[model samples]
Target: MEGSLCDLPAGLRGDYAAAGPDFTLPQDWAAYTPADHATWRTLYARQAALLPPHAATAYREGLARLDFTAGVPDFAEATARLRAATGWSLVAVPGLLPDDAFFAHLAARRFPVTRWIRRPEELDYIVEPDIFHDAFGHVPLLTQPDFARFLEAYGQLGDAAARIGALKPLARLYWHMVEFGLIREGGAIRAYGAGILSSSAETLHATTGAAARRLRFDLRRVLRSDYFIDHLQPTYFVIDDFSKLFGAMRDLPAQLAAARDAAPIPPGAAAPGDQPIP
Candidate 1:
């Protein structure tokens, strides 16, 4: 989900041609090889083992309610559970999609997940988001009411951001908060962002490594910040609660404009007034 559509590999490009107008496709559950399911299980077990001490409570609770450990989950089955929990459903897609199409799906409460799993060689790293990243990393949080609402609200704002040429800043909001954010819980920092939660290295690095800077979340600073997609994030914004995340949407348009007018803050640099979360 983090990569651009242009970044899709040439071989995988066929999935785009086979996709429907909305870029939606069937999960083709039966096509997954036994090896594919094994990869999912390995990734699941490894990440799950590391999550208890580092993951956000909401994410852990949501993950507990789903059955993703045996193998790659069937989208239809996962959809049923998600819809029952928070009015959200899963739809299969090729990989990264056009911005408009991606947002439209989210606005309708349908999450578009990649249908293919990563190869054995790509177990530790994949250039683009694979099924593991889209489903295992992102889906669990969709079960939380506030985080779910926040995502829908984000999708609703996509058109406006596009209209005003403010999509860059808007994307920064998604990158920093939705993909690589951190949170303070019970006096310790925890990971809530999909990007951090999904990777074994990042899960540890983001929570305990001294290399990255963790600052208290500030809507304006986040909108003006730049991030790295090819490597672990150098900086992360920490939110006090999901409610505050959803509340920031109230003034997003104005903030987007202001962010567009300001120079971007470098990935690991802190602004003068940035509140460091220690």
Candidate 2:
């Protein structure tokens, strides 16, 4: 999920050939073996325990509304709660989809959750996103109104960026904000990005560790910034609130164009105008 759309892994376990034009497939809830459910339970318990102190308010509250602790949730059941909360629904996808296909789903208020769950041996880490990452990590936040709006706006913007061939910069924005973003909450920095919330190592590293520099979210700064996919991020952009995240979309097309022309800021490196958080 951290890589560029073009860089997504091809060998992920999913029925890609049987997928519809939209790249969605049945979740096949009943087909999951007991071991698969046990994996979800183990993953859920570990990550859920880490969330309370480090996770954003919206994420925690939204997570409480659902019951992922039981095991892999039935999409239909989870979708019902999500729909009631934010007018959004979940769709099962093979794995990661192409940029346009992904954008279209978000624009239409449909989230494409990967149908497969990671094997037990791969619990600590997985190269690609699975059901646990897609459902537990990302789904909860979709229940928040402002965050929901920001994502939808992001999807809408993706189409425009595609036409202008500026998806690389747009992807950086997604990497920084949607995947690894932080926020100032109650005088503390909290993790809201799915990529951080889902991983035990990143959850602690991003919230409490001293390794990464936390910088205030700036549209231009993020657009021109680079990120790491295989390791902990060296720099994270923090937003004050979701409203500001949604507001960034107002001039994103123009800003993305400008960023595409500018030289990229290397991962972990600071720029002249960056406002570093303590």
Candidate 3:
């Protein structure tokens, strides 16, 4: 069926949970079918080849520590490596959790991951995050200290953003940086976000001879900018260093309010095209 897990017969939430842990998988580590292994291999091989010249050094090194081999990763194994590196860990959750729950998890230094993998036919894109996207795309970056701190700060700020009806803009910030951001390393740009690392198409577009403009990380401008949920990103924020991002949020609540106070720009407005700064 096209929807597969998502299309489970009605009243199936209980069934799904009973089938296994509702929030996190056991990493069955050895239960993967040949097909599953092939899927992982296919995705991994493609990204590995494409990311070296394009991906940030931290992301590249994190990928190695993940030690993706021939099958679905053991969350236990992955979490062990990640915890040692940055004290961050992954928690499994049913797909598309409520924003509050999502933020709560992140606030506590835990990432909510969808427990299922995408079917072979649906490899290029999936509506919700899959195991590949969560485990492969996102987890690796959690290994970096600065990125890890920024994520925690993001979560804490999410609470305040929610209270002020600013969660969307805050999420836009996350989408731009943690999920699809590029970074300047030694005077060269490279990919660091999970959304870019896990997808072959975005991986190429982000690094190759493409038409996208990579801008320097500007928190106020980023929160004011709009992003598309259903397509490739029209723009990307480039970070000089992940540490800068972490430090930028020291007063995230105030900054978010400031951005909100500024006249809202239409979604996707270019930085230069924004209303003149007062």
Listed in order, each prediction's TM-score against the native is 0.95, 0.96, 0.87
Worst 10 residues of 3 by lDDT: 1-10
lDDT per model vs. reference: 0.88, 0.89, 0.75
For model 1, what is the alpha-carbon lDDT of residue 100? 86
Candidate 2: TM-score?
A: 0.96
Give me the candidate number with maximum lDDT. Answer: 2
| Tens digits of lDDT, candidate 2, 1-278 | 22243445656677787788788888889999999999999999999899889999999998899778788889999999999999999999988888888998998999999999998899999988899988988999999998899899888888789777799999998889988989999779999999999999999999888988999999999999988899999999999999999999888988988888899999999899989898
Candidate order by TM-score, highest to lowest? 2, 1, 3
- Runs of candidate 1 with Cα error greater than 4 angstroms are 1-14
Candidate 3 similarity to native, TM-score? 0.87
User: Root-mean-square deviation of each candidate, in angstroms?
Assistant: 2.5, 2.7, 5.2
Clashes of each: 0, 0, 1
Candidate 2 Cα deviation (angstroms), residue 168:
0.6
* Residue 152's lDDT in candidate 1: 94
Candidate 3 per-residue lDDT over residues 1-278, each given as its tens digit: 01134433344232245333233444455666888878888888877888778889898889888898667787777778888998888776556555666677788888877666778997888777777888888888888999999999888776688778787678778888888988888877788888988888887777653576677777788887777777777778787888999988876787787777676555445657433211
Better of 1 and 2 by TM-score: 2
Q: Rank the candidates by lDDT, best first.
A: 2, 1, 3
**Model 2 residue 152 lDDT score:** 93
